[model samples]
Target chain A: MLGRGEIAIVGAAETTQLGAIPGMSQIMLHADAALNAMADAGLKPSDIDGVACVGPMMPQQIAHYLGITPKWVDGTGVGGCSFMLHVRHAAAAIHAGYANTILITHGESGKSRINATPRPPEPESLNGQFEAPFGPFGPPTLFPIPVLRYMKTHGVTHEDLATVAVVQREWAGKNPRAMFRDPITVDDVLNSRMIAYPFRILQCCLVTDGGGALILTKSDRAKDFPTRPVYILGTGESVETNMVSQMADFTSSRAFRVAGPTAIEAAGIDRKDVDHLMIYDAFAHLPLYGLEDLGFCKPGEAAGFIREGNTRPGGKLPLNTNGGGLSYTHTGMYGMFALQESVRQMRGTAPAQVPGAKISVCHGVGGMFSASGTIVFSNERP
Target chain B: MLAPGRAKPKPTPETKHFWDGCKQGKLLLQRCGDTGKAYFPPRPFSPYTGTRNVSVFEASGRATLHSYVIHHRPVPGFTPPYAIAVVELEEGPRMMTNIVECEQTPEALQLDMRLEIAFTPMDEEITLPLFRPAKGGR
Candidate 1:
């Protein structure tokens, strides 16, 4: 078992300009975020001894771009939540004395497609054989495959789904960096153009061009950094099925149920101890799944919890305070941004900061609920 | 004319049996020879027990609509508002497919509706097995 608070995030940052960047290529976005994070921590790239990142960009590519020769490297690209898993791996590596300082970067030209490598699995791959042939356009169509079954089982309504976007947009209003800051309502969400059945354009995540990075090191050295260190209390990562049709249950994610409890238990905290939450909202339904799977609310109760304004601004729990992928910038791999938001909230510097928030849980989903990573963060050392 | 942008399956050594069976208008499923557990998207080895002793068998092709989406986006070979669905085969595995021979509307694509397999030959090599609403004949 990993020791609690053994690793600390010494630095965290996103690309200087998020949303749409026509200038920076994908790798430059990764470099830009890396340098910015190094700057935030008052450390040069030379100080870093380890590197990690998602692919189609390799860890060595990120290390070379920033002029660092790391002793350890990680290219564990599972999906959007790969960065959370990176933090977990980085923590384990540090605890095992693999490397001292590790930098994990994420950059995707999801919208601009600038120098972006097309990463389709081989035609003979599992997805190509079983899923791609169905002509499911993309996440809009593919991710929502289980929605009808979930809604039918849970009694979650279109209005209830619409309310998720509405509530998150309310949080976005306070954020200048948020792409869409204007207030929206359930009516506005329902009235939006349909992308797929039961999913409006407003309900889907934004396809923006951006990147973010995080730097991790032992907690002992974290206090020496210029920026306030947010302790990595615990982490858990898991995967269920790459194919959405094969999800163990349509109503809940098997990965989420496993990763969330493991991290919370590792952190040695009860669900009530969490002061702020960031369950990745790549789609409106995800937060609902995240809430119930994480045990923040009972099954079938998350929609009502959001409708009651519990997760809205100034409610009992402030969720997706950075507006999430729904209104915040989602650069395809959105886990890094969620991690950055959790750090900002713990640091008491979030634009929509929650007052005296000590413990925050950031949960993420990758590839249509195929994988999950849960990381518990605390401003106070354990 | 071949439909532009419609992705076709590339059969592999392990999955060739499934595609070949589809060409013969049979929905073939693999079962663990040891445990007799049936599985889909064929594999050389049984997912259960990690046993290579697996047997292929023709299924009844009868299924129930487990879940689906009425996709409005225009993809190649498909018009707006098509039902991309997941159907649970009576033998016990769920697979992604298109619900065909019915109006592509939410009101029509009811969950738990009975469906039967229908093979559409994309080419000489690939015959995609789709699901259509079952008639009164069980």
Candidate 2:
């Protein structure tokens, strides 16, 4: 229960150029986002005392390159959801007086794939021994294992899958920063080249090079910052299983069920209290799972729920208002962008602003349901 | 020679026997004597009882299709539009594998269809256990 109004995100910013920038290295994206966030906060490197980041590099290296010595740092790398966990941990640290002005950063060249190094899992390890030999290449290939099963069990059709992609592009059309802004239809998705079964090019997220950073400090000290503080209402993090096959249920992520409710409960609010929502849409099926597992809809009902247009811009929920990873900048780890949207919606500065939106629940997944982190943000303080 | 990027499972302390069973043209699963919980993807100890005492037992090598995808993307050692699938073994655990010896299409690849194991030799030391439609399945 971390939402006692103890810590807040004072500043947040994404890299200036999100699409293909061949000149920028992975570390450069990180540094760029860090500088942009500091500039957004009207603070210098000297004002930061803590750091958190995820990539091939170390936090100390980022701190050194930024010319700041962090009194506290965290490299909680569980894929994309790593930054959400960092924000939670930083909040706890800020409350405990471990450090002040904590900075969390994320940068990845998911398309460029520059400077990304994943240590090969031990052949004896769980995935290496059993799962890897099957040749599920990447997220595009592997993630479908459970999603396909989910579609079958839920009786979700290809039309339903395409509808998810179609509606997301509607949101992307409003975002000048979104990469693919051409208005697309459900048939456009159903007819696209199949990267994996049931996943066309449109149903998947974009591969771009991007970075983002957020600054957290004590809530009492937040008024001094140039930007309005987006108060942290609650945060929750959990892991389901390392392998997709081992997940307790293919239709829903146990991790999401655990983390999502935990955050809403910690904030002491009901699901309806969430005025704006940002569920990590690494693929179309994710939001469906997030909606069901987060208890917005019952199991197997999210497909029809989205079909009825409840999550569209004018709809009740306004999910993935940033166009989502499906159309927005998804540099492999998409949680950072999702978190940024929640911050923007709370600040009333979103490109597609939800009118009078106060509370936002942003959920993210790490691997193929390998891990999850939920964050609840509010414009109001407790 | 196999394709350039096939990930050959390097057997470890807990998994050596499972690979060994595949090499010997048999399917293996680990069972705990303490809690009677059967598990796949061998481990050093039983997940149910947490006991170090476990033994390998032969499986029927028969399974039913739990789920599948006709992966249109290219994978290492595989051509596009190949079927990658998960099968629920008779022993009651699912394994990720490739379905072979049949056309990779929705008409041919049905869920919950009965299937049997077929081993492909990746190398002299490693053999992959692939599945194909059982005689009665279309």
Best by DockQ: 1
- Highest TM-score: which candidate? 1
The parts of candidate 2 lying over 4 Å away from their true place are A1-3, A118-124, B1-5
Q: Per-residue alpha-carbon lDDT of model 2 for A98-160, expressed as tens digits?
A: 898998988887778788665655666888767777777778877777776788899999999
**What proportion of the true contacts does each candidate reproduce?**
0.92, 0.70
- The backbone clash count of each candidate, in order, is 0, 0
B1-138: candidate 2 lDDT, tens digit per residue:
345567778887768888888899989898887977678778878887889888888999899888766778777778878877888898888898988888888788888889999987888888888998899774
Instruction: Write out the backbone clash pairs for model 1.
Output: none
DockQ of each: 0.88, 0.70
Q: What is the lDDT of residue B37 in candidate 2?
A: 69
After superposition, the stretches of candidate 1 with alpha carbons farther than 4 Å from their true spots are: B1-4
